[model samples]
Target chain A: MENEGRRKFLGVCVAGATAAAAVAAGYPVFRYLAPRSGQGGAAKLVIPVGELKEGDAKFFEFAGSSAVLIKTQSGELVALSAVCTHLGCIVQWVKEKQQFLCPCHGGQFSTDGTVLGGPPPRPLAKIPLTVTEGNITIG
Target chain B: MIRKNTLAILLLASLAFLKPALAAPVEQPETVCIQCHGTLPDRLGAPVKLWRSSIHADNGISCNGCHGGDPKDAANAMTPQRGFLGAPKEKDIPGFCGRCHPGVYKDYLSSAHGRALGAGGPTCVTCHGNHQVVKASLALINEKSCTRCHSFDRARAIRDAMQQTEGYIDDISRRIADFQVSGVDTEKMGKSLFSVRNRFHTLFHDVDVARVKGESAAINKELGKLDAALKEIEQSHQKRRVAGGIAVGFMVLLALLFHLMKKSYD
Candidate 1:
């Protein structure tokens, strides 16, 4: 009788422990497989259009990297990755010259992100954006 | 002839000593400039060999890149219409190099060095060299180089001010590189660091000790923030390691318990 009782108890304990272990392992896998929340790095950003003016640039984090929104002197809105192509340094917008200049190696870029001069082998990357209802929406 | 050879030897030796970080030349197809000038004796062929170790060469900026000639066409390579600009004179070196490094050129123009240009003042070639220009560093502000034109006191002061911040930058850079090697997405942090480093180096062109001291404090604050981020990453890694160890230990203990239960049945 004693042996039977002990055996039954051990079996129950083993099954319970196994179930607990399975849950501990499966929860992480389930979380990993689940769809991420919108705020988890892929959400669209909205900025007020009034915050920018002619020949002005506003730098902000987009999709987890540095990006910029610029209003050119011609009243055109442009979005570009602020990262310089030469050495990955952030480019500064020169309001006077109406161009982007990489402080790292003096790489120059026009408002459209095209490489104008210096050692940069390529242009700054362009980010897509839209203006609607006095708000700028970027992805 | 012996004296000339000795001077050339001395120059080469000094350059080798000065440029400890010379990068290996990036392989490129031979251009007409290299093909033709590489064979000529003495002064004519020397530029090709000297340029082989330059930062420009490492970036694949061949003779034609700066000289503005058609590298594809040997016949029209040197023609005026082909947009070839021959070697610049001493006075025009700043303008020539400034075509690309306009910010540095502008800073140089406003500096004491810039004001002294054309009247025995050091042009870009004086310190940076003409063909064998390496990456700029605090090493360029040595007593021997600075004392050539003026006293080393001001240069020494500026270098002292920058040394701590430079150390911070280098340490953070190494940490970032380590993270990158481990497959972490370090692009954003790396770019910010690069901008800070470049801006710090550009401050040297101004040659003002007070400004360097003032700006270095701000730069150090930025570096401190980055250092804190790196520290947070390190802490997270440690926590993960400990958690992994506990998980393994728990699994092993459960295995032992299962074995014990099986033995009891037998």
Candidate 2:
């Protein structure tokens, strides 16, 4: 009777321990596989269409870094990261030249983010954006 | 013994031939300018050797890049139709180099040095050198270089002030590079540092001591912010390490508990 009681006790302990181990291992995996909450806060930005004029650029923070929204002389809307590809300096828009100029190493880029000249190995990165109901949304 | 020595010699020779291929790839291909000028003697050949060690060469700025010629075509390389500008006169050096470094050129022209450009003031080449220009540093403001034109006292004061801030920038840059090597995304911070460094370095061309002091304070404030951000990351990494240790300890303890329970049951 005492042996039967010991075996019963051992079975309970094993079952409980196994359940605890499964929970411990599976919870983290579940969390890892689950969709994250609060993923898009400040990830999307909105600016009014009227804010940018032809040949004008408006620099603002986008997705945690400096980004610029530009309306080309041809009235085409474009968005690009302001950071220069050469050494990561923020580029300034030259109103006269209608191009982005990096103050650091004089790396120049066109409105479309093409490297026009200087030491920048690559062009400025383009950011996706869209105009909807007179509000420009950038991501 | 003779056979072994010959084998070693052959191995060394082969390794020497392979060294170029194993080294960093040349971003700019061997231009016609290098092909021709590399062979000539004395002054004609001197620039090629000097320029090979230049900051320009490191940045892939070949002869055709500055002189304006077709790097590919040898015959048309120096032709005016190919947009070749051979060499600028002493007075035109600023404008020539200014084609790329517009901000520095503008600042240089406005400084005391620029005012004395033709009469006695130094041009870009005067301090930076012609083809052997390396990266600029506070070392350039030493007695040897600066005393050539004026007393080292004022230059020394400016250099001292600039050197302090440059030290901060260099430290921050090294820290950021360490983070980058460890696979952290340091792009934003690196760029911020670069912008500040560029602004600080270019401030020298203005040659205003009071302005330098004023701007150095402001730039130091910016550097402080970057330093604080790095500190924050360091703290978080420490916390992570501690948490990892705790997790490992917990796992080991759980294993031991299970092992004891099994032993008791057995």
Candidate 3:
């Protein structure tokens, strides 16, 4: 009986240790193996200035969404929120009117990203821009 | 009875293993979000009213992108569990955002507030917040936001005054030309004159420290003396020109009178 009890105790200890190790090692591996479905980190994107013309706007992908780049006639480069302020609709540039128009709710925004009409309650958000070697990078 | 006890222990151990498997399947949509955000309109009908005008909203980034876990699980929303696949450590917030928004993050890092955050200063949440991240433009316009870091009015005043002085110097420089005439010997005027010119140049360049301390006063005083000397030189030149003109006038008159007298005698 004494020998049997000692063997059971040893078995239990081994099982517990195995469980602890499994827990410890399993987590990091799970995180690493899991699909990165969410936004993880900021990715650097480079855009050539030549691609953007004065009084013209271009949309590019950054951080899994569209970022709008507009060059005014005054040669001022502005990066604004392309996402509609009303209900998260994508705002498109109306070349004739020189404003951003939302198809979902008729929201209107000036070239500078100010809400001109419709349900948009605020001005478009400005993104920080940097020019390096004649390339315009927006973050 | 002994078998039952052993079975109970075994069941508990097995349950512990199954616990993680069940928990791992739970999704946390907030993990991917840098600031509190809501669902996208195209994907889900849920309204993110506040996020519409937010800076994050403008950038086209949605909630599920940063917070991690599963954003698609709208039917049975999963509560965030600690140590999950998408949850970020509090310390990693700045760096996580810095990856793409490097310029803003760089500015924040170099700013006083940024330095404070690095040296045990307020974390990103302290100023920007964790959830409900709004647009920076609104925050930037709020004077109270600045006062939180610069609590002292005197420091703010000094900063404002220095900015005003620098602007005045720019205006002055636009109106005056730096060119000196060829005849003027500016070097022989001594260190005082040069010091004044140097101060003016510094002011034009917007050297905040020198402008604020009134260092230009001494330089201006020396410039005044130099101006007086220049005026004295100009006056001497004018006097010599006048004397030469008078001498020429007298010589022309005397020659004319002599010629007339000779003609009469003939």
TM-score of chain A by itself in each prediction: 0.70, 0.77, 0.69
RMSD of each: 11.5, 7.7, 42.5
Better of 2 and 3 by DockQ: 2
Instruction: Please provide, for model 1 over B1-266, each residue's C-alpha lDDT reduced to its tens digit, 9 standing for 90 to 100.
Output: 99999999999987776442332446789889888888988999999899888888887889988888888788999988999999998889988888767667888899899888999999998888888988777888899998889999988999999998988998999999888766566766887787778778878888998889899988887788789989999897898798779779878878877887787787
Question: Is candidate 1 or 3 superior in DockQ?
Answer: 1
Q: Give the poorly placed runs of model 1, Cα more than 4 Å off.
A: A1-69, A79-81, A94-97, A116-139, B1-41, B73-76, B261-266
- List of clashing residue pairs for candidate 2: none
iRMSD (Å), candidate 2: 4.0
TM-score of 1: 0.76
For residue B44, model 1's alpha carbon misses the true position, in angstroms, by 3.7
Residue B40 in candidate 3, Cα distance off native in Å = 40
**Which ten-residue region of model 3 chain B has the weakest summed lDDT?**
B173-182
What would the TM-scores of all predictions be?
A: 0.76, 0.73, 0.29
Write the residue-wise lDDT of candidate 1 on A1-139 in tens digits. Answer: 7767777877888788788888878877997899867755457889999999999999997765678999998889999999888877778889999999876567899999999988788888888889999999987
Among residues 3 or more apart in sequence or in different chains, the pairs in candidate 1 whose N, CA or C atoms overlap within 3 Å are none
Best first by TM-score, ranked: 1, 2, 3
Clashes of each: 0, 0, 12
TM-score of chain B taken alone, every candidate: 0.80, 0.83, 0.33
